[model samples]
Structure formats: structure tokens, C-alpha cells
Target: MRGRKELEKYWGRPYTDTRDWSIYNERLVRRGEFYLSLDFIDHWTDLVSRMNTGKPGRPFHYPEPFITWMAFIHVFLQMPYRQMEGFTRKLSIFIPSLVSADYTTLFRRIKRLDISLRVDPTILSRNVIIAVDSTGIKVTNRGEWMREKWRVRRGWIKVHAMIDIETNQILGLEVTDESVQDDARCIPLLDQVQQHCGREHTIRRLLADGAYDRNEIFNTLEKRGILSGIKTRTDAATRSTGSPYRAECVRERVRLGGYREWAQDIDYGMRWKAEGVFSSGKRIFGETVRATSKEGMIREVKMKMNCYNMLLTMVK
Candidate 1:
């Protein structure tokens, strides 16, 4: 209610004109009754109606801008919903750009919004190379362990990610418990890549460690016309036969003149991108311990993924 003049100043300035500020302003008003006159609020509500939802029902109580703003605060501050709600209220007094909403309302709206996933095709398609890896997040109660060990105790939830070689954008992400094997996680992510690309015969290559060296994984890739650049593991019998899975073999197979040389090269350089995505998720959105029960954990993982997707969309 106090920041109307500042908001007006921001509205009057011209910039890249990428965002539809009129719509953004309307949403801001719904979050709190701004101190502005009725004319401004009316202009915003009219713009909101024209955004084209033909469903006959009450309009969204929390407008789009408010939702977007709440999401931004949630991620930027890395705070829980209640903390975020309190911060928004305090911020609204001096920051005209800020809008405040109740904590319960913010939580409900976040759970309901079905944010779309948007990945750039150019990044995914360039060179047809992908680096696959997985990292862990905590999901269970480990407060006892933390107290005993004098450190943070946590259950692990693994996020398997595939990153583009050229652009370093996350191409795909799949969440599972820490107990799930890496190879099992990779299978669905491969399917996701195919599904998202909308191609039946995209010839992309995957690079990964020996954890993905199973014959089934390789065979699956071969069937899909994708070249597997995963490092090979030596069986005991094969080792006894004097045929070892040597570094040269790996280098040669992934060498410039070899079957998966380019794939290996791309993978080696960009494998850390997947880890970086995990770190960013945890650091920015407090994605550490989500829910206690298995079902709750699954739902929390989806929410975190949604949050990650939204942040990526906003930044890019």
C-alpha cells in the first residue's frame, strides 16, 4: 500500500519491452490492494480478462504477476513459504516492486500452478552430444544424525540429469531415491529426451561412467540408433583372459577416429554441469529435505523440479 509512487515510476520508464507489464501490474494489485487510485486497478483487471481463458468461473484470486513475484522471492531468498510470506509483507512497505501475499495463499498457489517446461531445442540438438550424471538431495528426517554427528544428517534423493554439450543447458532431469541404480534412472531420461525432441530417430549419443556399463543400457541405445559412449567395465573372466578395460581402449573408442570419441570429449568437459544444476537447485530453493513419506518425497521432488524449470525459464 505504501509503494504506489515508486511502482508508478517503474511503470512509466521504457525498456526492452519484452514483458507485458500491464498484465504484471494487474496481478500485483490482486496480491494486495495497492494504494493507487481505482483507475489503475481497473486498467489492470481489464487487461487480465483479455488474456483469454474462456472458462466460466471466478477469476484467479492471486493474479499472474503476484504468482511470478512470489516464485521469484521464494527462489532468490531460498526461504520456506512462511518466511517468504513474512519477507514479502515487510518488503511491500518500502519496495514498490514487491507485493505481499499470505503464507497459506502462497503455498496453495505454488502447489496448483502447472508451470510448463521450456528447453531450447538449439541447445539440445547441437552436436547431438549429452553428458549424463546424477546427484543426491536429502528427503528424510536426519535431525538425530545431525545432532549425534554434529553435522547435517539427511536422506538422499537422487536427480539424474542430462546436459547439452555445447550450451550447457539441462536437457533432462529425473528424480529417484538414492537406492535406485544409476542405470535404471538413465533409461527413463533417455525416453524423456526422445519424447521432448519429438523425434523417433534422433541419433544422439550419451556419455557416462561405468555405472551405466550394463549391456541392457548399451543395447537399448543401439536399438534407438543412439551411440553409447559409456565407459566399459571389465568382467572377471575377461580380465583373466588378459583383455582389460584399459584407458587406451576407452581413449581409442572415444578418440577422434573412434566410435564415440566426440561423445566422450563432450562428456568429459560438461559432466559437472549436471552437478552444478543440483547445487543451484539446493542453494536457490531450499530443495534439501522435502517430505518424510515416500509419496511426499516424490511430490516434493516434482515441486523442486518445477521450481528449477521456472527459474531457468526466467533467467534465460
Candidate 2:
């Protein structure tokens, strides 16, 4: 006791304010609040509830913080769970909130999250103009069997997305095997959008490329009483006259050159936005690829997309 006091006396300025000694503590509190306000913690809690894990031990310590840390870590660093765990541990002293879970715990939780969790797209935007497109992601090893025989890649997954043209928010998303064609994926994606927006026929015009130029797609839009602003393909002539719907679209596009140009510009310009979204997702959230099974890969894809949608909701 006397020894410590003597040393303190020798040192001129004794430590008086423990709280004021470091700015990191204050920064940690603010950082945690920022993540919480963005609903990161709430989403993680929801995911954990669905996990229904029966690990049976004393239960993982600080599960909520662990999950929250994992989600934010995935988004910010865009690394796999193993890498994330290592990075966090190495840097844990700098980020107090990240010291909760190790790699295995975090990865197990991520794999347990349900792929079917319904993400509400209406939260992204209410704008009438929506852009639709699909981008490919490499699938897990189990999906290798589904790859096209002629294709060089082993297997791929397609993420069909719809974004608000005005705000660049992701209005809708669907993850499917890469073999699913763009036209085939559209109807379901549209249904999802309709359900979330709660509008019987709110989408005024859908902007898409020539890949969506089929008569059935046009008819689907027509049935919904929504205008299809998708560009008509030139090669469609082979299928145009034989089908009245294709002919009708061609005739309509031919009649309105200005409308055609406007639609093409809108479709082309907005297509890039979807690509930009994917780029941002991969760059910021590490949405690249992972699982070794088809189901796991799909789950991973949906989770990543949901995370993107959540981030969009935050920024908007």
C-alpha cells in the first residue's frame, strides 16, 4: 500500500479521471449507438430467434452483441467469417464491441439464418419508376452439377434485383440458380414488389434490357395493367409476326421512336445502377461467394442481399 502511494507521489500528476484518460471509450459508445439506430442489432436478434439453435451449454456469451458484431463486420470488411474472426481478434483492443465471438460461433450463426426470411422491398422506395436486372454470383460446390455443360464456370447463382430509378434503393431481390433465365425470374420478382408496395398496379413502367423482350413478359406486364418500357430486340423479328403479342410490342416501339429512345436510355442508364449496387455490395459487404452446398449458397446470397437492402433503408 505504502509502496504504490510512494510511487504515485514521485510521479507529478496523479491519475485523477479514469473516464477522461481515453477517447476510445466514448467513441465505442457512440459507434454502438450508430449501429443500433440503423437496426443492425434488431435484425441480428430476429435472425438469432429463427436459428433455434439447441447448443445446450451455458448458451453463447453475449449472443446479441456477437451477432450484431458479425453482421456489421461482414458489411464493413466484406470478409469471410474466418478472416473476420482473426481480424477482429487482432484488432479487438481497438474495437471493444468486436471481442465477443470467435470465428466458429459467428460462422455457425450465419449459416443458421433462414434463407426464406421475407424482406420488405417497399421500405426501399415508393417511386413509380423501377429498374430490373440480374447479376451472376458463383455458387457452391454442390451446385457444380447444375452448371451448363459448355460454360467455363463451375456453377453460378443469379440475383434478380429491382431498384428505384430516383433513389437507387434496392426495391426487390430474388436469388436463384444461374440457369434461371431473366424473363422467367421477372414475374416472381414483380409479385414480390407488388406484395411489398401493397399496390394492385402501382408500377407505371418497368425499365429492363432486351433480355426481357419476350411476348410473355410483355403480356405479364399488360395483365398487371403496367406499361413495359423494355427495349424490343431486332432479332425478335423471327418471333414477332408469329406471335401477336411480340408483333404488338414491335409495332408500339416502331410507332413511338421518341418513346423508344427515352425508354432505351432509361433502361440502359438504370441497368448500370443495379451493377453499381452489386459492386457496392461486394466492395463494402464482401458479398462475393462461400457455401459448399446449394442450399447454403442460396442462403448466403439472400442474406447478403437482405443486408444490402437494410443498408439502403438506413441511408435513405
Candidate 3:
């Protein structure tokens, strides 16, 4: 009862609109420019010449930049390859220099196109606080209708990502099968962030939820000198022989009174920025992938995430 009373003492902050309406409004308008930017047309010849140089295949008909542009559109608009083909064909009528690649070409190229995660170098140049989390994206949209009518289950793929808590930008992303566990990906995600930051020491702290409360996680972060803000499980034993780091954290939480107090001190609420990313990503790109093949599904998810990062960069 005393604990309940203590928790009740905390109240939500009053709502405030801190955004610059004029600047924010302009940023949203630029989102449309991503859909139909024609700047690639001007550099079409130069880009194609560069891509074809030292290549032993039939002279490439499309520039790599053009293919990249189409790939971005394919994921952002959630359109099928055929629709993308038609989209290009429609554009080619006015701009004769733009020859439309068929749906087959669009499929093959986008599958192999490298979509790298982008992070602000400024974030990497300083001590960083990172939040890690996983969210599932449906393998196919047909799962719902099939489940309702035929009782079929189409599982989802998990996206494990690490984001800079200060900037809320995704620094690393990995896609795995539905069977993969969240705790298993923690180190790999950290490794990616470490690679981006150029050194492991640049990561000052890591934030995550209870799914990452294992002793191995704490020990690993301790070795890297990264403070762990991972929440401890309610039933976790306060003493552990294997990982003194986790044991000490559990004891500290008790000393501080409870999870709420400990979380407040550590600013563990910042972990939810990862959830916000998932929510905004789903709302923008979608919750379901359109690809039928495993490789295609992975590439599609990466493209969606890359597009998300690009849009965020544009506003800045």
C-alpha cells in the first residue's frame, strides 16, 4: 500500500506544443518530393557511364542511381513491382530520357540493391546513449484474411534495431526469422552500433526492457564500459554468482525502493523512444511486407528502415 501511494505521487507532465509549426509544416511538405524527384534525370548519362565502366555485362541500360531511386519508391509507396514499372512508364512519356525498367528488372535490382542504415556522424563523434528493441513485421498481408477464412497462420519476422536515444535515429538494423529470441540479438546490435561509432567506448549507456535482463547482457555491457539501463525482471534473483554486475543492479533497485524509483533515476523511460520509432515506421511504411521470398522480405524491410532514416534526416 505504501508503494502504491509512492507511485501515485508521480504525475504526467502538462502537454505542450514545442514544435516550430512553420518549419515542421515545411518538412512534411518535402516528404512528397521523395515520391517524384526528377533530379536523377539530369545526371542520367554520367551515372550510367560510371556504373558501366569496367563491367563485363551488356552495357547497363539503367543507372545505379535511377535503380536506387526506384527502390526507395517501391518501399515507401508499398507498390508492387508491376505498379512501379507502370509508374516509370507513365513518367517516361514526358521525359523520354527515362526508359522504364520492367517489373522483372525492378524486382531483381531492388533485391540486390544495398540499403545501408544512416546515422548522424555527430552522434557517433560523442558519448552516446543507445536504446535497443525489437518489433515484428508481418511476412504477408494475406495472413489476416487467410487466418479469418482458412485458419492459416503466416508468421512475422523480427526487426532488431539500435537507436541513438538522444537523436532517435536508427543506427543499426537486423532482420531475423520469427523463431529468433530478442536477447540473442542484443550483442550483434551493439556490435553494429560500435562499428558505426568507430569504437565501443563511445557508447556511454544502453537502454532496453526486461527481455534483455539476462546476466550475459549485463556482463557484456560491463566489459565494454557501457552502463546498462535494462530493466530487471520482477522475479529476478537479487544475487547471482555468474554476473556480479546484474546482481549489484538488482540490489541497487531494492535499495532505491522499487522499479519506479530506480527507473526514474536512470531515465529508463527513454527506452520507449524505440517503441515510438516502431510506431512511426509502421504508420509510414506499414506493418506487413510485400515480398514472397525470404531474401526479398529482408531487403524490403531494410529499404523501409533506410527510407525512415532518410526522411528524418531531411527534416534536420
RMSD of each: 13.6, 17.5, 3.3
lDDT of candidate model 3 versus the reference: 0.84
Model 2 over residues 1-316: C-alpha lDDT tens digits? Answer: 4576775675433546455535645543544343444233335555455444776655454345456546655655557778877776776576554344678888777666554534445454444677788888755343445556645465577888887666566667788887788888888888876766675326777878888877778778877877767777754563445456666766666655644354544454555666788887767545446667777767777777766665555443
Question: What lDDT does model 2 reach?
Answer: 0.64
lDDT (tens digit, per residue) of candidate 3 on 1-316 = 4454454556234334687999979988988887776788998999889888899968888987788889888778778888998999998998999988999988887777777776666634378888999999998777566788997777888999998877778987999989999999999898888887884438888999988988898999999889889999776788886899999888898999889889888988889889999998999998998788887788788888988887877666
Q: lDDT for each of the candidates?
A: 0.61, 0.64, 0.84
- Deviation in Å, model 1, residue 295 alpha carbon: 4.7
Winner by lDDT = 3
Pairs that clash in candidate 1: 254-261
TM-score of each: 0.64, 0.65, 0.90
Residues 104-130, candidate 1, lDDT per residue (tens digit)?
988777766554344656434534667
List runs of model 2 lying over 4 Å from the truth: 1-68, 80-99, 115-127, 139-153, 235-246, 258-268
Error of 1 at 73 (Å): 2.0
Candidate 3 ranges with C-alpha deviation above 4 Å:
1-17, 123-125, 143-145, 199-201
